[model samples]
Target: MSQRSEAGSDAKPGNRLTVVIAQLDFLVGDIPGNARDILEAARSAERVHGADVVVFPELCLTGYPPEDLLLRPSLDLRIQEALDQLMAAELDAAIVIGLPLREKGLLYNGAAVIDKGRITARYFKQFPPNYQVFDEKRYFAEGTEPCVVDIRGVPVGLTVCEDIWSDGPIESAVAAGAKLILNLNASPYDIGKQARRKALLERKAQANGISIVYANLVGGQDELIFDGGSLVVDQYGQVAMEAPQFSEGLYAVDFTHERHCQPVSQPLPEEPSLPHNIYSALVLGVRDYVNKNGFKSVVLGLSGGIDSALTLAIAVDALGADRVRAVMMPFRYTADMSREDASTQAKTMGVQYEVYSIEPMYDAFMQTLAEPFAGTEPDTTEENLQARIRGVILMALSNKFGAMVLTTGNKSEMAVGYSTLYGDMAGGFDALKDVPKTLVFELARYRNEISPVIPDRVISRPPSAELAPGQEDKDSLPDYAVLDQILNLYVERDYSAEAIIAEGYERADVERVTRLVDVNEYKRRQAPLGIRITERGFGKDRRYPITNGWKIGK
Candidate 1:
């Protein structure tokens, strides 16, 4: 790696600049720690890589989406302290970092360029996105100007996360005589988002005829996962260099000012399959949420279903098999095949496994409620009772051993309120809360391809809660193949029932599924927060009044 320090000197020669992209992770609201990390990375960039400039991701100091933390009275004071610490270091390389800047009683999502121990330039984010998972408009006053600075005798422009999404920011920088653009991002991942980002940057770079360097943050924060696929796009819009997604490192791109700023090309990293990307996102999300929240390990109820089987594989991958525990709570309705598959996978994965029948607990609960349900026939109450008993058992183990319980419900079930309130929904984290049923099967197959950890029967068998005799998911809901398409249209695309029907889905299926989603807001509201992978998840991504009287039709 020391050879990299001489990269600039060996390049085309006249006035070469090496800018290192600091694709790193920082915990939200940890101002002091984040500042320390920034200084450490900058020092390494200068000492090891001989970098002329080190650019960090957006909001690296306070971390991205600080949310209501930005509203605290002491935010400005803490930010100032962090900046003072950075400026005092006086490192040799110019460092570009992000934070919330308070000026004249207004807060801005801003970036500061520090050169040789002093503040040289600052740029506030011009566009503060408010849709989907972003709420920047609630806290920031958008900057009205562009910032271009000189580094190593080359003109460089600065832009924050949302600025490049629109046309104005990059164009303004080009008009301001910037030969190269540096974009600091805390961009989250969705399906095929990386391709979209590269295409967008390619068009922007070609249209402006200016090279662009993108530095993105990596890691998981609550429900959000920022995949750092930092790269350099040349003036002609060709991807010159790229760092792999879901990784953290300092990637250097060399540039020489011959006629125009030209980035030295490097071999591009191979793009992973979509299943691989989604699987990696889930692993990172679960690991960070569990570890960041200070849990030692995780426990989940494995009911021999695809949802739990996939979740078990993910947990083991994220935290290792030693840190994961699987419990099987079987009732009278549970099949021998279901029990056999659960045990086989648990043993194969080498995780701690246990079985405790819910018959006694269910009997106890039913007897206690016999008088209250005097004349009521056996219905969902009995089934729900079985689920709640299993939930209580899992929660007890979690409480006793200090392991967080992982809920195993997928997005498809979450959409229609198929999950019990305190039953299967009782847990600290859910790994599949954003994954639909169809995608769940795809991931299960993908995981098996890597290594056969999950039992084949688990994937081949029909999914059931085993709360009632001979019951399956299809007994109450439509086929997953049709249901997931309806969900994607209605939940993600915001299509109305009529609009979904126009997409060729049956009107009865559309109306029933849409109504279930509408009325089940209360259930989802109480469910545990999970990793978000789709464009619209049931977390901060979607908000609706649970008591609204709005109709289902357009």
Candidate 2:
């Protein structure tokens, strides 16, 4: 439900400010459309909610992380046209919206305050974060000035994303006589990003004796998913207004400065469980990737393993039963239990299910290569053939039906080069790309709690590729619990082999796993793009050369 606290609801006999938190989903590179949305929302906030000011997210004009689109020759024209649209809108409520402001030679990440059909004030982003999933320094120069504008007799400060992440912007705003700071954010979500943001904002508010209004972008843009958990922290570090995560809408809060900064609002909702939050991120990432990319449906090879089962469930939840298709390909080594579980889960989820046997295809390939393999013993070539056969079939269907194929490889398998390239890794997108194997089981159980869609056996049984007879993941891999820890430290934390070994891990296991990760760069490079749920994912966060000679030191 939308919470609203109109001006004077609990304020003294003085003018109160109604600020609208426009937590909205915007498409990247849609300059004109974003401006239209801004103007439209501003109009409603003024007409319906009696809002004195409406605050939008960071980079709402060109969308967050416009990337190289900001370099387009026509970018200036588009942004100027958008500003003109807002001026033409004649919105009564002053709107604070984010956009790119190009000066003489350098471009800046900026926000503009529009009121009375004119841009009154502007604030540039002082910190252009260049770390993981952020390369703002590549495109934008750092801003140095603080902008504090008067919004109906209230001194309000403005800062873009990453500005408040540092200390200077907020402190400057306060020093410039800002009683409240409006920080625009396009901050993407990871596992525990919300908690860190709340803590940081609370401390900033409490220490500086200033109220903070944070508005974050919502929706998925490529691998990143922005959870729309917009919030307002009062001067005393009290959370006066809290918005729900993963949903987009306009939220309102009434701030009165008669005596001191005080915001009145209803009780906020609690944060979701960890698994629940991860599940929602994947779902939003999948939904937006499919819808935004113009895919009608998605298809995936639903092996009975937990990874594929979890991927299938996520696809169903993201795009719905009608938009998801599951294909079970049986080989000679494919167990009866595997086929049964795959079928049962698809039936429970109400997705279109099909079965195809790759024995004939495998036999034909083997027969063609019989002469060359006359003296050689059976090896990974045969095992990879089975996986490649399935890939060919899925790709054939995708080509014929226009359904995008979703790969089901998880982070654990991708990290160790355990998957076959162009085989299981062949797909347009991966739902579990950043998820580890152990977390895959946790999410499967979490989904069942919502409603039993995945089979219990699928979650309880041992994971296998079902390539050779009696094959299980542990046959060639360390235990998932141990391997995931090593992978996390090495891949996400960038810990060296010696550093990981010092963490009480077996030295041999650490060396072996780190070597696999290093050698598997080629595989990960060719893999499909997936949802990013962790602080470091293979897609945008971690970048390594296909050929390198760096070694870990003791």
Task: Write one digit per residue (lDDT tens) for candidate 1, span 11-50.
Answer: 3246688899999988999999999999999999988888
**lDDT by residue (tens digit), candidate 2, 53-108:** 89999999999879999889999999998899888886778899999997678899
Error of 1 at 494 (Å): 1.5
Clashing pairs in 2: none
Prediction 1 global C-alpha lDDT: 0.90
Q: Rate the local accuracy (lDDT) of all candidates.
A: 0.90, 0.89
* Model 1 stretches astray by more than 4 angstroms: 1-13
Provide the lowest-lDDT 10-residue window in model 1.
Answer: 1-10
